[model samples]
Target: MTSAASPHLTGGPETLVICGRVDADRAELTPRGELVHGCADILARALAGLPATVARVDLDMAGVHFMDTAGLQFLDVLADHGRRRSLTVTATNWNGQPRRILELAGLDTTDPLTGLAVTDPLAAAPPTAPASSAVALERAECLHVLQEEVEQLRQAIASRPVIDQARGILMATHGCTSDEAWHILRETSQLSNTKLRDVAAAVTASAEADGPPPSPELRTALHRAVARRRRGTGKAT
Candidate 1:
């Protein structure tokens, strides 16, 4: 027997509508509409509604036409939900604007949710080189790029929880939106010449009891980043 949820939106002109069904140990969620602010909470609630028997969750993202940077939080919600329950969560059928958004975010566009690249669309294209050696070299370069991307995806997946935690801390402490928090973190990382994950970890640690705050350099960088955001937007950040 299969159980399904009623189709509904989170209530906005550009909102996400979630509808899905569960069968045995697998739950399939089909989300349509724009993935924007408040979308993550809606996704979290939908995941909570699933039965304990579900060990895997798959999202069909074909209908999802648009996604902003905040959409990453929607993915984070799925990841956090899966991690807490030891479930396998995957979002597939990504294309168009959402896929482009994933690419811009340095995520795996082919399979963003799992951070897995299922296919190499570039490999199928014939090499334009006239010489066999040149073709081989071109292929090798492509292979190298693919390997780099795979490694990046692995690192991104591993760092996601800490980064999300850091973003939440920034949002709460600074009274900023998720997008603003992300920009702050990124700007801090670049300005301080530090890795983004390291910056995130520092932010997370600073919020915890008895945990050390960010170092002087990072602290200065963060302040500058927040200031820049506020000045650029002409609003609180």
Candidate 2:
């Protein structure tokens, strides 16, 4: 295995290992978090060295302790590039903050983590129907409306790498896939009775801070604090 303390570099099997901190200070600042320039550099290098017949790229994040919006954007760019190349890109060891970030971005998936042999979690759930004919159409309509709302929220935050980064962080932290990460975010938001955007924003902010992600218990407390503060002063307004 390659050392995880060096600059990001490409190795065998179309894999790229990004070691060390992503230098959040050097990244461009946005409402989300810092954006690392090094990510772009790494992506450019990785693309330049693409081998013929390469089907996927694996990004090992076990050693990465910190990243910002730019780093998240870099991953997004890499994912897009891989899609364009008709190649799949898998990000591993995406637990903790990194996994959470990716989950927010909607890029973390279990297929890669499970070596592509497992079934999709979202696809496994069966659809539900209304209990009576009187409200069957109404239930269907409600479900449709909910789906539309979800789609709208996704579209509204679609291009924001901060959201994606939060998703990634959750994926890593929970050992979940991208879809599972998203479900967790959504579920958390519902349980806490908070908006998805607010939850995502909080996750991004926590990841951007110094040090590793707080423990799950700490994370829950922080989320509650943030929510309470938002309610009290509307400071985030």
Candidate 3:
């Protein structure tokens, strides 16, 4: 039998969809869509919605074209569920950007739920000696840095569409080139002491008929940015 789970997120409609089919004692799950912020929760719900008779779960991730760091959490959800329910969970058939993301996050691309890097035989070997306090501290710091990088990447991916829209708006309104639009947005963001993505979102939203205008600070900064660009290019503002 096939099953699906749907969950609501704050900002937008759900992007991930989990479809499952059950065999004798195993369930095959295929998740298709962009795995963004709340997708891990959806995966959890999907696992919980599985039939009680399912003793094993295999996820085929080929259809998942895009995934951010939340994909790691999705694997965690499956692993946690499998442990709690005494079920075997294996994820495979990962390809494209999702697979590359898995590699970047240092996960087992073949079967991340097992937390074993199958490609490297030495990774499974026991540690030769306990890590010293200094070494442990360094490792922890490295992990913190890695987490920050992953979060930055995720935010960039999430913000790209809005940023592009903002750039397009500026291009159309001012008859500026795309690079000039980007420069204006960046300058305005810096001048207004705001995030580039936030500035882009404000610019995009203000262009809509019913959307709220940007804050006064953003407006002033944006004006100055455009005026400066006009002066630099020897064009009328």
Candidate 4:
């Protein structure tokens, strides 16, 4: 059962598709689609804001089971967009009904191991599979989606240890508590238009080099957050 509604998480706002940590140049999107038949427009809208670079877009379609004409058409459209933008759009881990559909549309979604193109659809007939086969495939799709979520959760939690170290460093340097340090991290993330994990990673890296915030940009953003908070409260006694 593919759900278009957002997936509720504990901390922040819910993200429907759980896109892999998108940086400036690349994005990995794993759409949890049981049947990607009629929702091309919704998917397209979700993928619109590509960073102004030749994005290496990797579409992980392991979770999709069924794909109709509309789904294949969307892939073609995405391929065209990639060519126009000099991007490399590749969809991988396709099998069963979805793979058959893509093959008919002339989109080469080949095997994971060999990187060799699977059999030509025109050269051979599509295989006839049983209902149990589909059920098994659906199960596999669910497992793949679950694994994706698990990996995302792991990355989300992995940031905390480093962020804690950064918080301690900030507390010692600025005479602030853990909460105030977190405020600085959140504010810097907001002001610099960067993810909190990235900010934490930078701070950790800086500590390795025996320095403050790794970059001047980070330094500036950190101080700006403190300044803004101070201004709101007036002069501190």
Candidate 3 runs further than 4 Å off:
4-14, 116-237
lDDT values for all models: 0.80, 0.51, 0.80, 0.61
Looking at model 4, the pairs that clash are none
Mind giving the per-residue lDDT tens digits that candidate 1 earns over 76-106? 8887777668788888888886786677565
Q: Write the per-residue lDDT of candidate 4 for residues 1-237, one digit (tens) a residue.
A: 122324321112221242443656777667555433345554565456545663677777786665544554556555655655657677778877667654444446673212222233352333555765875586456445544544565587788798898788777867776887899899999988888988888876777766554577887998898777666557362
lDDT leaderboard ranking = 1, 3, 4, 2
- What overall lDDT, based on C-alpha atoms, would model 4 receive against the true structure? 0.61
Give the per-residue lDDT of model 3 (tens digit) for 158-204: 99999999999999999899999999999999999999999999999
Q: What is the lDDT of residue 73 in candidate 4?
A: 51
Measured against the true structure, the TM-scores of the candidates, in listed sequence, are 0.47, 0.32, 0.53, 0.37
Query: Per-residue lDDT for 41-111 in model 2, tens only?
Result: 66556554554555555655564543434455565566565556756555566455544444444444432
Off by over 4 Å in 1: 1-9, 116-237
Candidates, ranked, TM-score: 3, 1, 4, 2
